[model samples]
Target: MNSLRKEPLGGGSSEPLPVAIIGNGPSGICLSYLLSGNTPYVKSHAVHPHPLLQRKLMETPGVSIMDQDLDYLSEGLEGRCESPVALLFDALLRPDTDFGGDMESVLTWKHEKERTVPHVVLGRNLPGGAWHSIDGSMVTLSQGQWMGLPDLQVKDWMRKKRRGLRNSRATAGDIAHYYRDYVTKKGLEHNFVSGAVVTAVKWEGLEPQDSGAQDSRPLFQVSGFLQNAQDPSPQPFILRARNLVLATGTYDSPARLGVPGESLPFVHHELAALEAAMRAGTVTPASEPVLIVGAGLSAADAVLYARHCNVPVIHAFRRSVDDPGLVFNQLPKMLYPEYHKVHQMMRDQSFLSPGPYEGYLSLPQHQLLLLKEDCQAVFRDPRGGQKAFGVSLVLVLIGSYPDLSFLPGGGALLTMDPSQPLSAKRNPIHVDPFTYQSTHQEGLYALGPLAGDNFVRFVQGGALAAASSLLRKETRKPP
Candidate 1:
């Protein structure tokens, strides 16, 4: 119920912003779209598998779906998705086709510019965030249609460019391009502050009693610098807002092994560097087998790519092939045959001798102990004996964490402990599922992967939740 100050940070405008979104990923783009008053409406005669939900939506024809009784609407809907409301949105969009079937949309969007909220989206990269930095040729786990933003389908965009999908699969480069173009295509370009790094964000003092309610929210000061073509140097800037949204997805910070020689030049964390090395012929089949660590999809991708180049691969992982909790095991085999193939190799190689996989080898239940400067990897075998293997390069794909170092408490604020990284699989931020708001931080919201909505399709629902909460607060008159 706090009435914010109209004072400028330095020589800027006096009016304070209603919202300031962090990260220009899909979540940020979708939130910006909503804040711009590009409202979504349920089409009349919108056919859904859930007749009761459809009936309720049709009754309020003029209301935006974002403003509907989301929790009630989300009930009784089951999907292979995280957010139920997001599943509801998918149901509305695709109607009866809940599981990967192609169909027409049942929702419509209209620009109601008058309802727009004043906000800014400060992002480190362009629009796609982590997608921008992924290997160009690598295929995405999700289908092409699933990667698109709400309005413009990625397949539709590809048609414009005279491109077609191969078995509905989209490459990482295509997805990155689609998200970058979505911001401008949807007219949300003006709201994004691309190529800016947030240095620090701190909760400042609350306004006096004259500001409105006794429990007025603390003012948030965001300090950052812009990096762009105009000036390569850092241009310092400051911004303040009443509502803060953290849409920063987990990708910037790569999780480390903490072993000696892990930081060596030949050792790579992200896939981009390894891809670059492979493409440049720096890593060849004649070289010692490339050592890959981790059992995630990224690790699988590393093995696949290495083998494709005729390079022998020696994959190391802590988990066994039959571990159901592994990321590769969760993917649908038909859609992700490449990943499953790598998993199959792990399974096949487990019982056989080392040379059974042709150019690939799996070290199941192997624990890496040390790495020498000469590219010799020391690992503890399943038998508890330490052994060494020479390798051309070491690729660590153990997954990544979000860079929340900008916060005054650093990443420890979000993860509770930096030594133990925040993981979407294990330690996602506990938020109000309906509003995506942080339970401990008033006026603060989380979107996208930070709030556990990892998929591109689910991210919009998180955005919608935040926008709905924001609009509700905006409409309430000061006490």
Candidate 2:
């Protein structure tokens, strides 16, 4: 863990300390909120820099903070920016504003014309021959496998998610709105910028400076920017600051399928586009067979969405049929006495009762298989296999690995391969659980999934760590 240090970097007099945070995910966003003094849930804990000190840091005309969004996501939505959650819309923006990408338009159109699915009925939780109405079936939204056990049923898990909690569908987008709203009600300056992706971060060490108050401390210079990766020759962003923080997230690197035809637009690294299509009714629910590869949360979410759209989904994995499903992986028979006995019995019979997935037999004759086939590569069938048989989409929910190409020279200042997992110590950026500063880099700090060594990467944990780090820094008294 790194202890927080504030040193002067000689740059310019009467200049505000310009801080640049890379990546706009939870970590970067949280850092930006801290600098602006607008974090509600975590503000009370930060040891704020003396206002006089901050004013000095802000004196430099070169000082400016940037987030990933140029505008809030709710800028155009009718009810998007109204509620407390709507605050996240304060700086919402479409990707195209900076990246020259057009995926947001497709998402919005789909959200408009897409069929409204109140929810989904999970067939896996039902008893044999158990029937249910379309709206009454239990659709599994989260899986508990990441918790370590594999036999636990999705419905029975609590630590994974608080299902009964209010606003079950609350997403990161919703949280962003809520945070922005809080800032508005408090009348704080919510300065933010979006529509750009950070391509690089250049760190310049600290220097001594005169405060013009008879005594001066060390200040720092840090600079970087928001630009498109597609540009052959893009302009570089620059900023100067007394202190610097790096909060780019693991997801900053887009994961790749490394398979053939992956270059096709139909295959996506994120569900933003897929959700858009579903919302637009472009991807209709029907008898069409849809195949989803891999068994992670993304795959589970995809399955539920397809089910809601009335699409018959076929889930294929490299795991054996005897291999555990999420339920088995999460709540194995040993952990739950009753379920264990039941699971053991089913194992003996080579048959198990229907649950979430199998429970949705309303249409009857839909197939969902668990296969152990490796996705060596993806290619169209010689005769357009099932696409002609109404297999409208072949969504490979296989996991994504980090793509460091966006980093200048196709790499980052910190070099840890996402392709290979680390054993905690070898990881980059040591964080002080107390101060959240990087032990190796004084002004640099890290938070979110990228900071922790937990096997399961979650947005909530990152937000919590970031909030804690912010509070600790705000509350600390300078020596």
> Against the true structure, whose lDDT is highest?
1
Clashes of each: 0, 80
lDDT of 2 at 170: 26
TM-score of every model?
0.92, 0.49
TM-score of model number 2: 0.49
- Report the poorest 10 consecutive residues by lDDT, candidate 2: 120-129
User: Candidate 2: where are CA atoms >4 Å away?
Assistant: 1-18, 23-173, 186-188, 209-237, 276-282, 285-288, 320-328, 331-391, 400-429, 453-479
CA-lDDT, candidates in order: 0.79, 0.35
Task: Tell me, by TM-score, which candidate is best.
Answer: 1
What ranges in model 1 sit over 4 Å off? 1-11, 208-213, 279-281, 350-352, 411-421, 477-479
Superposition error at 461 for model 1 (Å):
0.7
Q: What's the CA error at residue 238 for candidate 2, in Å? A: 2.0
lDDT of 1: 0.79
Local error of candidate 1 at residue 294 (angstroms): 1.3
